[model samples]
Target: MPDAKQMVECPVAAMLELIGGKWKPVILYFLGSGTRRFGEIAVRIPTISRKVLTQQLKELEHDKLIMRKQYKEIPPRVEYSLTDLGESLSPVLAEMSIWGKKNVLEKR
Candidate 1:
């Protein structure tokens, strides 16, 4: 057992510190299918502002959770996809989804 005075870095606590927000997980959820353009993600998560989406994407990329690829062309193209670290988070998200459905949503 950890001493009460000791600081412990629990996995959930560490993860939440990185991706805890209104949009990060949802952004990741959409990216789970594969790569997506900025506009594509914005379309699916319509409630989030463009500015917010950009911020979240930057943060995810910085944390090495998502990879951003840019294509050079007449019209520049960019797409976001999960890194190996991010893909590993899918199981955790799935469990959260199951619990939310059973305990939270079902209660309502």
Candidate 2:
């Protein structure tokens, strides 16, 4: 657990600290569907730079929300999938998607 001093008292704010960001949520959303390779994730989110994606992935891994698996092969391979905790956010992501389609996409 993080030190109380390090975490904001507000639950939402603290939750945001783990998953909130321009890219983190997006990354999680993609991973929510299934496991993805580094390139696969990059392809889904074209606007994210490789460097930033790497950083965000590391943070999510550190937070225990995602799992990174490496396979021993001639050309090294890594894949990412959500942990149980990460999958727990699926409903939240689903709701957000529905809301976006209704309130944002449909409005336009």
Q: CA lDDT of each candidate?
A: 0.91, 0.93
Tens-place lDDT digits, model 2, residues 8-71: 6778777888898899989999999999999999999999999999999999999999999999
Q: What count of clashes does model 2 give?
A: 0
| Lowest-sum lDDT 10-residue window in model 2 | 1-10
Clashing pairs in 1: none
Model 1 CA deviation exceeding 4 Å by range: 1-8
Every candidate's CA RMSD: 1.9, 4.3
Runs off by more than 4 Å, candidate 2: 1-7
* lDDT for each residue of candidate 1 in 1-67, tens digit (9 for 90 to 100): 6564443567666789898999998988888888999999999999999999999999999999999
